[model samples]
Target chain A: MSTDTPANSESALSPEEVAELRSRVDELETELSTLRTEMDDDSKKMVIIATKGTLDMAYPPLILASTAAAFGYDVTVFHTFWGLEILHEENSKDLKLSSVGNPNLPVPNAIAALPGMDRMTTRMMRGKIEDNDVASVEELVRTSLDSGVDLQACQMTIDLLGYDEDDFYEGVTTGVGAASAFQEMVDADIQLLV
Target chain B: MSTETTETLDVKGQNCPMPVIKTKGAFDELADGETLEVVATDAGSVSDIAGWADSTDGAELLDQTEASEDGETVYKHYIRKAE
Candidate 1:
């Protein structure tokens, strides 16, 4: 960051330059602690990222977050873009699983996107999940919060989607900006981007 | 369900995240230094639970074992809550 670095190839750093460099080192150390104080300083911290809004993709991050919290790590889930809808009141209640454009979907993409196909696929998906005894999205969200996994919604995404505080589920933190969430994730010892 | 078990979490037939999700719920209710036994049918729990326990500070994973029964593999994890 210094342009005054020994302009002459053979010359060493001048005393003034050396003094400036040492001062810069001190400034850096001071800034390091300040940045670290940016978020909750839990000893064992974990972050789960939910960037995909699809119904199926929603479960992984929330489930992992709850479990990680149960393991005694403080956990936070940062949702952005489509992922933010996981906290939407009505949407989360009956989150629809889609086979459209998904390789894992049994039906062809074109067929999967047909009218009435979403409903059929959703029912089938729900039936299979229920039959397997997998935890439902609502159950997982409640469990995640109870397990101390903080659910944070992205401020930018919320505004971009034209959602208000009333739109999100109860207990969902709605004002988290990316800069703050990113810093929190950076401080966490373990992080998962799902 | 036994009193001595502190907590017993049954995640039978549930997959990866389900097992862990249940475990976290049960574990959070425990007082510091309490123990929990989680029984899961998901094969993924073996590493998933281990990774989780290792990543956190207060929870100490005593052990994890896998056994095959009736043609199904079950994983059990024993963890002690940190004081």
Candidate 2:
């Protein structure tokens, strides 16, 4: 680098010049703060793909979407495949927690396959949920809707499952295809598959 | 430090998402510059409340304190409504 001493190196700026510089700094500061506030108000977006239907799997997407909404995020949960069971009017409340094929299940595989094991496991898990003060899946879904989180069910999945458009809970957006879900996911600041 | 109205929200015995969710609901009812005092028993709320405040433009976390009540550790957070 070439070091060059400017003619003003030994001279102080005039009072008028200092005042102009101070005003410029103030204007810049104002602009910076305005920009910051605008950015914050714009709010971030989050999108989640919920593809599981079991009682154990339902909580993640709903809980995350609701929490993100609470944090002032524009949140969306796209339900596809078995995930649509979460929004199903009749099936949501009865979604079962199965022990079969779940390594996390404490019981051995053979015992897990016994008759009525799924119901037993579901009841046990629900008890644990209640003891810990965890909100139920139904409560979380309602909370998500009340907090302005978009809950969309896949149109293709509904047709595949022979479910009517009105099969989901009220306020749930029906008939969202993969393309629309992708549209939401592409612009989101955060995306998750659960 | 302003004399704006301060509201108290007790989320004791609740876990993650509940505390934050209830805090958001309470803040929605607050006027701009009002303060909200949150009392929670969840250990996760210490970071959850702060993170929520930091990320939400309409909320500002002012202070956090920890205390023991009935042999259970409690967390308190002071947040201000920012419009």
Candidate 3:
């Protein structure tokens, strides 16, 4: 008896062997595709909610949201109450410089004696933030918008405060109520009230 | 039962969201079937880290321990990587 292998012999490979090899390749391809899709989805799923406003309270939320977005999270800053003032394009100008008797303002007494305190405080805060290697509230807002983070203002507060839509900075999404804001928070993987 | 492997991430002194952000990044870098241990000094991190882990499916939190360090409370989380 002679034992020899032929190059053109299709029968050399049994039908089961061919089928198993093809199935394994198909399975591997499916798994690879699924993994790629999952990673892509994970990258897109990062979400954050930030609330900004009120003297010292204004910076944390905005800064955190912006930095989070910079780290690739889809972020949203919900500006309500005193927080809405930070969204005003002319917040440093038209807004009052006095913290005295401002119920919403944090550290109201601490800023009460500084002349032209509101403006001076804003500038000083901006400088200090820069000095600390942190982004300014305005820059953070801008960066948040640029990074595709939602910048939502509170509509009810806007109406209550008599602020027109035009008073807000560019790229801000029009006012949304608390219910809507809560819905947003619910969808977010991370939410901050600062 | 075999002993499970673990990874650690130190995010002390960082503020809110940073610890969460870094933890997420560490999770992303981990291989499937691994676990991550995160230590953070931020007060908010206790809730934030737990919330993040719970929101995602497959991820398992093995442990969460709080300890006082130099007058500040620190949170330590042990999370298993889920596919």
Candidate 4:
């Protein structure tokens, strides 16, 4: 009948303590597994579709894709339609901003009506973005390349539009047809049309 | 002196993951136990930096400071290299 008997018992742990200890062991096991997983490459995949050529519309997709790549995720950018223009190295340098036919573009009415409106619109847009401290489309392209974002131009669109590889910026991946692009889209975890 | 080194990257004008991406590249070039300092302008970067440091294991966020520059708020982060 000594109190030492109870204190020295093999089953000294109370039910609450046993439960808490089990929970702690589980947590430690989870943390170890998470650490191992982080060390492993099980990277995420993201796909972005760039179908518009306007400066405002161009940066978002590239920026997002590059940013995702920086975070250890594989990113692919599919350029189709007007978006393919951004990949054109030669034309990209002189790509004009168009406000006339672009409905989604935000432009002042008077400026949108000017002669050679596209050039004027481009200047206005560039100025506005600069004023707000945003990077230019060219800068975005450079960043995209530096970040290793896979840039794929639509071959069907390129041929249909009479474009050659020389027209696209450096670091662009091989031009793929529509079916390839569709396959890529289906394989991605995230699909964004920007 | 333990010879531990720390580097700082200023990406105040950069938005989104530029700060984080560039920081990752910088971290890659450092030896284990080195440190990195990152300054970012993207509002989301505050949380992103902390999250990246936590998830990367060997890395730990030592400090984070937010300051207003030219009417924009920029975040400064100090990360220790852990691996």
Candidate 5:
């Protein structure tokens, strides 16, 4: 059961045979370490910036973060400026896709600004998203957090906007300055601006 | 599909990341060299699970397949622990 019990204990191996086996072990170890290094290099780390606050913009960063995390990548999403709205506990619930300036819409700017136009447009967009099975912002964030994606709030923005830490969702790991978040992103293998 | 597994996980009706998240959790319960069988209903898991197992340091993907279950398709992935 022990390594000391040799494969052929009944007879001793010649010195040359022992030397050959030792060399073989050394070669295997080197090959294994090389493979290990290759694997390490291929493992991707993702850092994404969620800079836009609209419902349409919110889905991309959260979706990609969850997807990358599911691929066993270390993922982080940093929220700053208006993008922090997606992370806000109360505002997130009312997040809506804006139809303003959407080139795809056939309506002219004047019609687009009609009193009830925003609400109708938002409802239409929301319906399309649901019908298409696109992941909702809340669902995506849940998946991202459950997949171990770190959500960070930019402290400078939070202070400038006079928001408290508790204003964000439950899983915000850090409230850091923009520079700190960028530093983290710089070290990551993948960087995305959303 | 061809590999034998010591444990099996069913993540039916889940979407995208849940399958991989649950699979990773199952892998934690396995000892080195043991295989885990993960079954998921999410279409995205086909690539997600494979990529996760490949990129993970000590994870090995032994086998992968798809089969229909109750008129819907499901993905089955077998993984082996390496470290």
Candidate 6:
């Protein structure tokens, strides 16, 4: 901003003063336009921390990420601990649903602990998903990837679990630390933990 | 009040996120100020589409209506690209 001031008197003004005022107005206009451009460049972002790797738990983060991306939001999902299994090329499809200790499962805990019960529960859940026309975990993962959602795997978890980086699906940002993921979460308009 | 639809998208039988996802793809192909009409069977789309349009830039939700076709309920949404 310029410090120059216009005289309040009803007297005629000098040409130099008028020119200076006009230039000052031009500078302010330029600054206003720049500010507007910067505001327009800022896009909404969403971040989710996926801590559960169960078959049913994986759907929430993936669904939210894909949907947010569809709404034109920049989305990122940080997979840590057991959640890293979602990015594993083979484990993604092999995820199992545990019926034991889950009140939602009508079966008794003793029965749920029987041999092959987990497999049976997983199969039943898959059937329910198919009957409802809902998307499978595989489909949702593929959709998230296709929609450009960032799937970041925690590097510390991978090292602790003794998992190979090459086992993850293509396009996954493996080896991301907590600090990097937190940076994204801080900038995101929405953050969730599942 | 005199706006006309510029494109139509059919997402019947699709579940959560698919209807919204497909709508996004269709909207991308539409020109500015153009309108898109989406037909869906997912009951959840009523709220999903509304929420999506509310959050998305350049998207203006015009209206949403419900109807029954061949013994099945259907939802239709009209949105405009206002950017």
What are the models' TM-scores? 0.69, 0.81, 0.46, 0.72, 0.71, 0.82
lDDT of 4 by residue, A60-89 (tens): 887788777766778889898899878887
Per-residue lDDT for B1-83 in model 2, tens only? 54344899999998878999999999989999899999999999999999989987778888888999999999989999986
List candidate 1 segments past 4 Å from native: A1-42, B1-15, B24-83
- How would you encode candidate 2's per-residue C-alpha lDDT over A1-194 as one tens digit per residue? 54575646557788899999999999999999998987777668999999999998999998899999998889999999999999997899899998899888799889999999999999999999999998888888899999999999999989998999888889999968989989988978999999
> What is the C-alpha DockQ of each candidate?
0.53, 0.62, 0.04, 0.29, 0.20, 0.64
Over A1-194, each residue of candidate 1 has an lDDT whose tens digit, in order, gives 79966567567787899999999999999998887876445458888778877678888887778776666778899888888878887678777777677787789988887898878888988898888777888878887877667999999888998988898878888778978888998878988888
Q: Write the per-residue lDDT of candidate 3 for residues A139-174, one digit (tens) a residue.
A: 556756765777788898899889999998889988
Which lDDT value does model 6 have at A131?
A: 85
Residue lDDT tens for model 4, B1-83: 13233777888777665677788788777787777878788888888888777766577778887898888788888888776
Model 1, span B1-83: residue lDDT tens: 23245787888888767776667667778999788999888878888878877776687888787888889888889988988
> lDDT tens digits, residues A101-139, model 5?
887876787788778777788788888877655566777
* Winner by DockQ between candidate 2 and candidate 1: 2
After aligning candidate 5 to the native by TM-score, how far in Å is the CA of A42 from where it should be?
9.3
Model 1 residue-pair collision total:
1
Model 3 TM: 0.46
Off by over 4 Å in 3: A1-52, A92-127, A130-133, B1-83
CAPRI tier of model 3 = incorrect
How do the candidates rank by DockQ, highest first?
6, 2, 1, 4, 5, 3
Candidate 1 global lDDT = 0.80
Worst 10-residue lDDT window for candidate 1 chain B reads B1-10
Docking class of 4: acceptable
Better of 2 and 4 by DockQ: 2
Task: Return the candidate ranking by lDDT, descending.
Answer: 6, 2, 5, 1, 4, 3
Question: Model 5, residue A47: what's the lDDT?
Answer: 91
Q: Which window of 10 residues has the lowest lDDT sum in candidate 5 chain B?
A: B13-22
True contacts kept of each: 0.74, 0.85, 0.00, 0.37, 0.30, 0.78
- Give model 3's clash tally: 1
